[model samples]
Target: MPLLLAFLFVSATVWVTRQAAAARTLTFLMTISTVVTLGLIAFFLFAEAIPVFERMGVRILLPLEGEMWDPNTNTFSLVPMIWGTAITTIVAILVAGPLGVAGALFISEIAPEQVREIVKPGVEILAGIPSIVYGFIGFTIINPYVSSELSTGFGALLPIGVVIGFMALPTVVSVAEDAISTVPESMKSGALAMGATDWQTMKSVTVPAAFSGISAAVLLGLGRAIGETMAATVMIAHVKELPQPAYDVFDSGETLTTLIAGNFGPAVGTEYLLSALFAAGVVLFLIVTAISITSQYIEERMKRKLGGEV
Candidate 1:
């Protein structure tokens, strides 16, 4: 039976490989598989979360005034977690944006060929380092320094934001570098021939021309920051309350990703608590999906503006 099954599998593989129509059909099937998988995931999340919505209504899930998330006591306001996610993402962008753009500009426009080759690879290598390693570094190195020098706390947003920013920097730098490098050499030459300095040409011409790509890169980085989980779960203080004054980066806070990661285990037997976690997952999925769609749209627009077809 095994021999016969193996022979049948080999025959099918060989037949598919030999036929163009078969190959195309397989590709279409794979694409549909991805869409189907995503649909099922969304459906599962919504289905699991529906119980909570039915039991408590939408107000409990999205309360405007209350700031607690105690499932044992029955409170389930997600505002604090939502705010934490937002503030951390914004802080990461603010830290990573200028540094990433400057690094891209330096590598693409200013560095000598040898220097550019070395620096670009080095920057790209940072992306391959595991997120857990970054989390460990933040917890061990950054947290202590901040505790001694600034505030004595576990969940200051600055250090976590900076670490997450570094994690996201490679994406921004790589995309922006590719975008800047794609600017036609003729444009730079024209500017130089007209007596424009290199800096002037880069600042006034190359950057403006690549703004759409840069914007897409930033959005992609923001998505990365928002969706990061293990690193944040380890480094953040994981407080359940809203930050005092609502703008305090130094206060301990908890993000949706971390909240879900840290609490889902205990919530398994509790129906409403598990559903609430699933609901948070749905929220995160929507946020990341929106950012990805926006990034793709910007990239498509940039390509069209550059005379490329869709």
Candidate 2:
């Protein structure tokens, strides 16, 4: 029996290594299986979400006049959370976008080879750090700074958004740098030959050519910002209303992700409250999905464009 098991394992390994067709077929099956899990997730979210809609109608998503999202009074509004998500994402993108692009440009184009070697790996290392570390940092340091300096209170959006933006930076830098690096050297040479400086060539020839990929990187960062939960939850307050002024980022509030995450434990078997959280999950899922799909599409376009296929 031991000999038979060893033989089977060895034969399977040989089959996997030697047979390209079999290996590819197995990999394809694995990939398709992952798609099935994604489908299941979508199904579960909607399954859990639709009940809230049925019970409270669509107005549950819109802002109501009184206490927003009070499960006790049966008042369930999602607008405040939605607003929080939107504003935080916007601020994150704004903070991360230019800095990430600049970092990418410097590493891929301007930095010395030694500097690039050091900086690129360092930047990549940031991505490996856990989100909870970011949350703790925000909860401990940034939260207090913002509350004291900006008069925004403990859970203000400015600090939360900025922290989230830095969290998204590695993705933006990695993607954008790859895109910028793909620009043909000949393009830069041509621009330089036409009396453009290194800076001008980079601005005119490299950056413009790689703009689609950079845009995709920004969108990817947007997706990250939209989906961030733990950091925002730790950094934000459980404010149950929309900010008094619609555009106020300083006002403390919970995002949809934070709302669901903060409530999931307490909401166990609490019918409408559980449903409400799931409803928030549904909206969060859709927004993140749309941003990811759009980012992917743009990345594909960038690849095609860079390859001269488009």
Candidate 3:
């Protein structure tokens, strides 16, 4: 089997990598293999999506008011889902970014060794919780609470976004904490030596120093939120229309992930619906890839800023 050959090849390559020359060669091969694998996936995804575009024209990518995503009726507009994904992800990032950064700062700069020992691990443990559990919490508690108290739809945007934000929080906290920890003590010491208060030094030196990594952490959180399936599925209704008023976070909606996830059983052999779903997948891929590439650029710039290079 191809998998067995790949496994044996990898094993033999790893053995050969015990020598320095073959190690570099094998590393290059591995990197190329990964890149090629990703390329193939992207190619196939786009290829599968082409049928929808050809059948429906580019109207599939346009915003709503006309057609909503009922594939049984052959309507395949993607904008409402895009809007849902964007709104929820924006809410999630807005919630997670500041909180995660603050958590990171507290853990890296303010917490004593014993406190860091406890809190940091506790935060990381949150990352291990199954996302489905978060979904259940949202569906059971937050959704009903919002529906009762706020008098909104049970599957409102704000509550679902908040749940996703909290789900992403531990990742942001962990990565941002590492970024803060990477800040040289010398920089903080210099600020202190200049008669800066600890708070002032942290505000001026540590945060700025760690800003890019923090930024990347936030982007990663956004990516997680955008790609989230189980939580979004459980917490939100599968409505395909744009939210009434468009600005109301209390509106029920479908997200890109939930769209793909929710329709699979029904979409099994239906060409247009399947293709539209794949097209959604393609869009999701592009958006996430753009975020990842931007994060990488920011990280590189951060490295240059920290390294005393022009």
Candidate 4:
């Protein structure tokens, strides 16, 4: 509906401009509508968010200093879930970053036109696949393989990480491909004309030119991996205890999203449960927002370095 209204407004603005003497009015209307839309969205997110935190003792902020998450015990430390979410996202991004960049490079720089056309569609199709399908695939295929080959028990994290890496792959590929493709062709041609190797040109010049976009893509992928609930829920063992010191990659851990999803139904209407879920949400929001802000800052810095902006 927002998009439809945007399109209709644009059409009306164009029509008014064509008629003469009404362009200013149309522009004013467009500005007002855009502000009103943004204000409404902000109001909604903030309104619900306040109550959610209020119930969770957010004003007192006890969860930060507490030890356990059990509500009946009045223990509500969020460190474990926070650690799990951070570690999983970090591991998944480490795996996905290089692979996603390589995939994007192949599509944007190396593949022949015909091959690119064929492969691009397949990559886009991956993004269209349902999250539940990925979850089922992770649970049925990846989980058992990890449990059998990696350890005698507690081998779920590795599979969930891999599944998340796969799930975020399409986003990274699509976004990074656009970034790589946007690199000035003249720069590539100049490097090639100077007798530089294809790999050298890509590594030293093209990728540097596209670094901001690649970073943005990576941040977006990390956001998706961090917020993913169903695949993690299905694939992970949903361990309640803190992960052991061994730090086995195969061991399962509960992330913030999985923790909330697993507990919400049973804890409904209970202030503790409601507050806990909201706290998780608040944490997720902060993490994603941080990523976005960092991406924008990097983008701005890169633009300045590249002289795209000053």
lDDT of each residue in 1-310, candidate 4, tens digit only: 9987887887778776675545665678779988898677556555544654554454323324434566775456566677677677877887788899999999998999999999989998998898889999887877777777866354367678778888898999999999999998999999999999999999999999999999999988999899888888887787754566536566667888998898989878676556666676667777777888899999999999899566
Cα distance off (Å), candidate 1, residue 88: 0.6
Q: Is candidate 2 or candidate 3 better by lDDT?
A: 3
Residue pairs with clashing backbones, model 4: none
Decreasing TM-score order of the candidates: 3, 2, 1, 4
Record all residue pairs in model 1 with backbone atoms less than 3 Å apart, i.e. clashing. none
Pairs in steric clash, model 2: none
Top TM-score model:
3
- What is the Å distance of residue 100 in model 4 from its true position? 0.7
The residue-by-residue lDDT of candidate 3 on 1-310, one tens digit each, is: 9976986787687777566765776688789889999999999999999989998788888874566777767878998899999889989988898999999999999999999999999999999999999999999999999999999987998898999999999999999999889889999999999999999998999998988889989988889899999989999988888899887889998899999999988889889999999999999999999999999998889889878876
CA lDDT for candidate 3? 0.90
Question: Candidate 3: TM-score?
Answer: 0.95
User: Each candidate's lDDT (Cα)?
Assistant: 0.85, 0.88, 0.90, 0.79
Candidate closer to the true structure by TM-score (higher is better), 1 or 4: 1
Candidate 1 lDDT over 218-244, as tens digits, reads 887898899888788889998878888
The local distance difference test score of model 1 is 0.85
* Tens-place lDDT digits, model 2, residues 9-34: 86588677788765776577668868
lDDT of 2: 0.88
Rank order by lDDT, top first?
A: 3, 2, 1, 4
